[model samples]
Target: MSNKEQLYQERLNRYMTAMDCGKPDKVPVCFGIGEWAIKYTDYTFQEVFYDSEKANRIVEDMLPDFDVDIFSGGPTLWWPPMFDVMGSKLYKFPGIGLEEDNTFQYNEEEYMKAEDYDDFIANPTEWLVKNFLPRISAEFAEPGSYRATIALIKSSAAFAMFGAAAGAAAQRWAVEYGMVGQFTGFTKAPFDTLGDALRAMKGILTDLRRRPDKVLAACEAIVPHNIYGGIAGPGADTRFPCFAPLHRGAYPFLNPEQWDKFYWPTLKAVIEGLWAKGKRMFFFAEGNWTPYLEKIAELPEKSIVFDIDTTDAKKAREILGGKFCLQGGIPTTLLTYGTPEKVKEHVKRTIDELAGDGGFILAPGGVLMGDAKKENILAAIEAAREYGVY
Candidate 1:
């Protein structure tokens, strides 16, 4: 085998071993080139979001410099061209709605109303295509119009093109750079599906009090769909977990009782369903889930790689250490605000505290902000290599 292929296998083994709650030669370090990389280059945020080829090139340029095991992701999260074709009101991209350098802004609104709950619960797929699509896409506001027809055609084509390009990019990264992706498929908690884009935060919060049953029904309707989505990626690959960035289920977003009643059940169902198919979840628990760690422990052993954001690390190691792999130790804030020395210190302490026995990957606990310092990021990786040996 070529050198790159051998390197890929080594990194993959490290990740797989850690996922199974065992130690490899070293603690696997996950890294990503976020929008912060844009500042180091001449490209504006608009250029990167609209041009996938350019974004891929940007990532390729950065790859050789990063000596890490798992690649979390590339610079652009979504190709804006897809949203532009559909006239999606979901986000306002850099150049289209704001300045060329500005980050995209989520334009949250109650696209799915409380009254629409019954229709959505009855047939979720039909509801989304028929009602939700029009509400969220300005071009599709008039369902049968010429503009709407053209929009759907263009948008669907863009979706296919984006998927194909992403697959090619992943292959290139694996073959040429010896990089391993942390996960494959993408899904969200059923409640997030209903809350994030459908009901909006305010609307969902209000519904919890006035229309609790409808909220429950909507989440129930969404579970099976999320399960299907979690496994429907390229080749339905089960070697890696499916990415599920959980929102709303975080602490104090809903009180413990509300979270128990509304959030956990459907999300757990999605996880269990995926697990039955030999799939695992990258439970990217973004915010503080301190209250729910024990509850999260009830999942089948090795069903998830629980990510730590603001969730207490020591407690997570105690609750989930052996059964599931734990990822994330460096806080994103440290990458943005702290010095290289401080980042290295935190890395050493984190390895000592959380990764002593195994089942851990050293990575940033949350999405790295665009302003995160490159020096500190490099320091974290360096420290991980230096201190992570078992």
Candidate 2:
């Protein structure tokens, strides 16, 4: 067999083994693209977004230097131009990261005046089709070698929260208004139309306290769009979930009780809805899901994969057991500061501790930053291949 084919087969074997609750030649490792990559590679988000050929070239150049097992789907936030035309707002910091800024002056008052659930429903498809689809279709249609595996689609609940209309309206809008408006609306909306426009986190919390049923209902309505058969579903091979972080703004202010009460129920509903459609969820629970591990553990087996950041891996293994696959826990901070030997030691320890009975994928707790040391990443991958033997 050719060298490339052999390496590919080796990787596939590792992946299949983990999926089947068996041991392979080694533990498979997956790397996520994050802010660190931007800093380390000094590549612009636009370069990664618009030009797949350039992106692939960069990945090929980097692979020899850092032998990661799985390549990332792509930069997580690659919204098209339609988002801007739909009046979607984006929050940009000098260096930290970029996200949809849903704080709109008009939306705050509108939501406050919305006396009942009916006031929140808006059709986003009209906007999406009229405004966004053309640009994305054009971009993807262009011939390029570096096609990504995963495709992220916006959820109706998320769009509604940010002030974009959902359903046929959003899709029709994308088709009609062209790509600019569609991209804008898709990126800038809230989890559900019920949340506050100015303060999306507070809005969700308030809804959880004041109008939970409405939130639940809204979530249900949005799930259809988030699935494979629906307007926004990314196909079977892709693993993408409608991601919503619990806490907004800075950390430390997150209240666990509030999260369980306000977020968990709705999230559960959304996940279950997607589950029924046969899409496995890769939930990126950014904060400590330890407090709610029991609840999370209740999710269907092999259908949900929890990517815990900064959570206790040992406790996670205990709580989750064989119920669901667990990804992540390798700290990014260590990758930057530690030596190659130290990184290998950490990877070995984590694998030895976690990879006993299967249902685990080794990855950084979050994403590898652009500035992360190449040597450290190589060490992590090497450790997995060498020490993670069956």
Candidate 3:
């Protein structure tokens, strides 16, 4: 094998072994590069959002310095212009209608009417194309109008061109840099899709009580798309594993009785579908799910990684010890404020305890934020180097 290929395989092996509840040579670290990349270059959100090539280059330049096991920054920040042209009710990207320097934000208004729930479940793709798209963007709502049609075509072309370029560049960088955690895919629980896109958050929560059956049906209905996501990706055909970033189904969000009825059933079905097709996943549990420890424990063994957020990951290790490969949750708050020594110390403690057995990887609890300290990020890598030995 070529030296480049060999280096890629070596790192890939560590993550593949780790994610399956087995020990690799050492625990792998995933760089949670979200807004942090934009921040790193000292670029304004407006500056980077407008210049996709420059923004991408900045991230690529930084990746080698940290030398993380798996490279991130998939589908990097390429917004603004499209929203500007289409008139998005969904997001406010910097400069493009949003006041200068303000970071992009979602505007989740009720795009779906309550009475339309059954139509959504019956044909999600058609409903989205026919109904959801039109409601949110003026361009889609008036497709036959010449100005709208021209604007839509131009903006979509630009968005696709940038997305394809960024994605390809990320993949190439991963291989050439010998990082190669090329596994990138996304599947939200059907309920989150229903909440984020259709019912809106408050609306969905209200519907859980007011129209529980429709909510359940909609969640079930979105499962096929979720499974398709699980079963297809760079991860599906290669060593990299597909992961599900779970949102909106944690402790205070839904009571256990409500969870059983609304969340777990559809989510489990999505996971099982992936497993049956010979795919594995890492479920990015996005909130404090300590209350549902036993319920999480019931998932089929060695088929997933549950990288937790806002919960005691050490306790999670004990609860899910051998069930799913546990992952790290380096609090961005601590990383931003603590000394480098303290950051390293915290990471060491997490590594020593959770990875003592294997079935663990180190990762940010959430996407690495723009404000996280560079020294602290370096310390996470240093901790793995110093104490993450098998």
Candidate 4:
């Protein structure tokens, strides 16, 4: 094999071995070129988010210098041009609605109402198309109007174009950079699918008390779709885990009783369903899940790679250790506020604590923001390689 291909295999093996709760030559390190990377370049947030090629080139330039196994993703998450065509009200992209240098902002509203539960439960896809789309898209509100029709066509075309470009970029990263993608498909916990963009936090919280049954019904109805998405649809690869950014399922959002009743069952169902198909969930638990660790351990072995954001890492390793891979060590805040020496110390300490006997990948606990220092990021990677050896 060529040098890049050999490097790719070695990194992939290290990553997969750790995922299966086994030790390899070294602990796999997962890294992402987040919004922080843009600050180092001449580009603004608007430039990278709107231009896929520029974003891809920036990531490509950084890949060769870093010694890491898995890559979480690039500078920006979405291509704003796709949303611009549809007049999407979901987010105010940089330069479009905000200043050129400002990061995007999510405009969360009650797009799905409590009264709409029955129709949504009856036919989720149709409900999203007929009701949800119009609520979120300014140009598509009138549905049959010329502007709405054109918006739909243009948005769909943009989706296709963006998907193609992204696919090509991923391929280039794999072949040229030898980077293993963190996950293949993307999904959310059923409750998050209901709570995040649909009912909105306030609306969902209110519904839990007044219309509990409707909330339950809607979450149950969302299961099959979540599973399909988790696997990236039919015939998609199960080699990599599916990314599931769990939101409301975290502690305090739903009390133990509420979480047990409303969140765990449906979320567990999705994980079990995906696991049955030989797919794993990258359980991106973003907040403190200390109280829920025991409950999370009930899943079938190797069904998840539990991320430690604000979650107790030691407790997670103690409970879910051999059963699942544990990812995240350096907190994003450290990368932003701490120095390179401090970051290196933190990485070394984290590896010493969490990388024992295998089943750990070092990464930032949460998404790195634009403020995260580039030097600290480099230190974390350097320290991981130094201290992460088995």
TM-score of each: 0.99, 0.67, 0.93, 0.98
How do these models rank on lDDT, best leading?
1, 4, 3, 2
Estimate the TM-score for candidate 1: 0.99
TM-score winner between 2 and 4, please give it: 4
Off by over 4 Å in 2: 1-3, 33-52, 64-66, 74-76, 79-88, 91-117, 122-199, 228-233, 238-257
* Per-residue lDDT of 16 in model 1: 97
- Of the two candidates 2 and 4, the one with more favorable lDDT, higher being better, is 4
Report model 4's TM-score to 2 decimal places. 0.98
Q: Which runs of model 3 end up more than 4 angstroms from their true locations?
A: 74-78, 233-235
lDDT by residue (tens digit), candidate 1, 1-390:
999999999999999999999999999999898888888889999999899888888899989989899998888889998899889999999999999998889999999988999999999999999998998899988889999999999999999999999989999999999999988888999999999999999999999999999999999999999999989966289999999999999998999999999999999999999999999999999999989999999999999999999999999999988999999999999999999999999999999999977899999999986899889999999999999898
lDDT tens readout by residue for model 3, 103-199: 7777888899889999998999999877887788876677678866876797788778766876687667766677665355667788888888788
Residues 90-130 of candidate 4: C-alpha lDDT, one tens digit per residue: 99989999999988999989999888999999999999999
Candidate 4 clashes: the total is 0
Looking at candidate 4, the ten consecutive residues that score lowest on lDDT are: 230-239
- The global C-alpha lDDT for each of the candidates, from Candidate 1 onward, is 0.93, 0.52, 0.76, 0.91
Predicted model with the maximum lDDT:
1
Candidate 2 per-residue lDDT, tens place, 1-390, comes to 656556655665565555444566667677743434544455565555334444444544455445445544333243333333322333222222343221112213332332434433355455334333332333322223122101113323343433332234323322332111101111101243334332245666666667767665654554555443321432343233333333331123346665555456655665675567655566666656677788888777765667767777889889986777777757888888889999999898998888877777788876565557767877888788788766
List clash counts for every candidate, in order: 0, 65, 0, 0
Question: What are the candidates' C-alpha RMSDs?
Answer: 0.8, 11.1, 2.1, 1.0
